[model samples]
Target: MSHYKSNLRDLEFNLFEVFGADRAFGQAPFDGIDAETARDVLAEVNRLAREDLAASYTEADRNPPRFDPVTNTADLPEAFKKSYAAFMASEFWRLDLPESLGGTLAPRALWWAIAEQILGSNAPVWMYSSGPSFAHVVQVEGTEEQKRWARLF
Candidate 1:
């Protein structure tokens, strides 16, 4: 056995079997998209995570990041910055948000499936990217202008 094993089989089993969360997308916003399309989005996001975001995580851990006391800025390694850009570019940041706010409202299970891959790769990175969903929740509970600001964030 190798240390680099991915739990893709488990992901598949969870998505298609076990919890049976695949049926939630049959109405309203999700009705326009099928399960296969959802799977494609997940696959593409995971590919980007492995090839781009996770590329520098080990090196980042080795070097860590240095902070400038004056500027109050953490000067992350170039590798980590590149990885962060790649992760952001995946648009994984916008999952589970309302379309009005430039997001695709996906099935919760599919959302969790993608989350597992991101979290497995780097938990902090996953949390950072999940801000949009949090913002969406806030928007729902906020006033109109506040909702606008949430979307902007």
Candidate 2:
């Protein structure tokens, strides 16, 4: 844990000062989401990454996913599961997704910045959680019926 650290300072500075992302607010697609709200979301996601996600890096490595014959699916280690649960509770995955898919529809810069906290905290988590991200993209480019189905993911 001591070796892991998140660059929230640079992130906020880039969003507000260097880039002046605040001006993007109160507009279509990004309406109702001001600078303060975006900052708050970033802060919370960072906290969750540090407190819950980064907390188990070493342990989760030792305990990898295993095969569950009865379920015919891989059972994620309890350590990983714990971290996954923490991430799911935060629901930060919706930050980058479109509003049609029940997401915030935030700016790509801010969305990816916030995502860096979670995915960078645990690389494996990003790989495992690719379903939602993929679903979001498909929902955006896919047909109407396909978008409806992607929502289930």
Candidate 3:
């Protein structure tokens, strides 16, 4: 019942072989995460996406979400919410985000590579996963004082 499929082989190829990400790891920012850890993270994320995300996909499509004009909100099905929570529990959204925001900083290309795989499995979940990432970017680009505000946010 799972339509979600990921190409982990190609992802690893792009990360280690094609991009030479191994050279960037074991250094500042990425000091703790090397190529192996990155691959493991990717594999785990792929599994969560394929199993949990994929399972909820069809149920959500069948039930769908309802927009409440009165409340100016869209009510999501419990099944869809369950899928979102599963992805969140995976904590893979933290990749590429700053450690301050609970993310392990990795190469941008590597980050996007794994992220794209999850997105392909379920785009709506990935779309909502951008909040902390946006905040992290603000923290990095913001002034010193603004950094505190970003963290608070």
Candidate 4:
């Protein structure tokens, strides 16, 4: 059984009530996404975190990754790989990215809220999936040449 538990109500309260994420949505940059859509996104991510992502949390902890000194690499457990693949396939990570990178313009609050669900379920999933966020940073702050390289991520 998974040990992870998500407090989606609390998250929604903070985002919609306290932070006024609804006001931010359907506005500049977040034009396409509205309050309803944000709520749906949160619900979906919460479900995913509780089910797919949390499925392998304990197994991964028990098995861990096997490091190869000679090859300088590690082999992740199959269970963890499946969970990682599920998260990648969800494409929710694209919410915070720019439209140029095939992502919608989401508020930072929304992105962090999404992050909390994933992180609370399985930390390694969030940690391993930092490539897109890192790429976004590079695309924004890097020179033209470096920006091109960031797209590969």
**Residue-by-residue lDDT tens digits, candidate 1, 82-146:** 87777778776666788877887777777778877777675557765667777888799988888
The weakest ten consecutive residues by lDDT in model 1 span: 1-10
Q: lDDT per model, in order?
A: 0.72, 0.79, 0.79, 0.93
For model 1 the local lDDT of residue 123 reads: 58
Candidate 2 residue spans exceeding 4 A from truth = 67-71, 143-145
Candidate 1 Cα outliers beyond 4 Å, as residue runs: 1-4, 143-145
Return the top candidate by lDDT: 4
Per-residue lDDT of 77-139 in model 2, one digit per residue for the tens?
A: 777878888887688777767766777778887877867887778877766666778998778
Steric overlap count per candidate:
0, 0, 0, 0
Quality of model 3 by C-alpha lDDT: 0.79
At residue 25, candidate 4 shows an lDDT of 94
Expressed as tens digits, the lDDT of each residue in 1-153 for candidate 3 is: 687778988888877898788788777867878877877888888888888887777777787678889999988878779889988777777775777777787778777877777788888788777777778878989889978777765
RMSD per model, one decimal: 2.6, 2.1, 2.3, 1.2
lDDT of predicted model 4: 0.93
Order of candidates by TM-score, top first? 4, 2, 3, 1
Q: How close to the true structure is residue 109 of candidate 2, measured as C-alpha lDDT?
A: 77
For model 3, state the Cα shift of residue 88 in Å.
1.3
Q: Number of the top candidate by TM-score?
A: 4
Backbone clashes in candidate 4 total: 0
Q: RMSD, model 3, all Cα superposed?
A: 2.3
Instruction: Write down the TM-score of every candidate.
Output: 0.83, 0.86, 0.85, 0.95
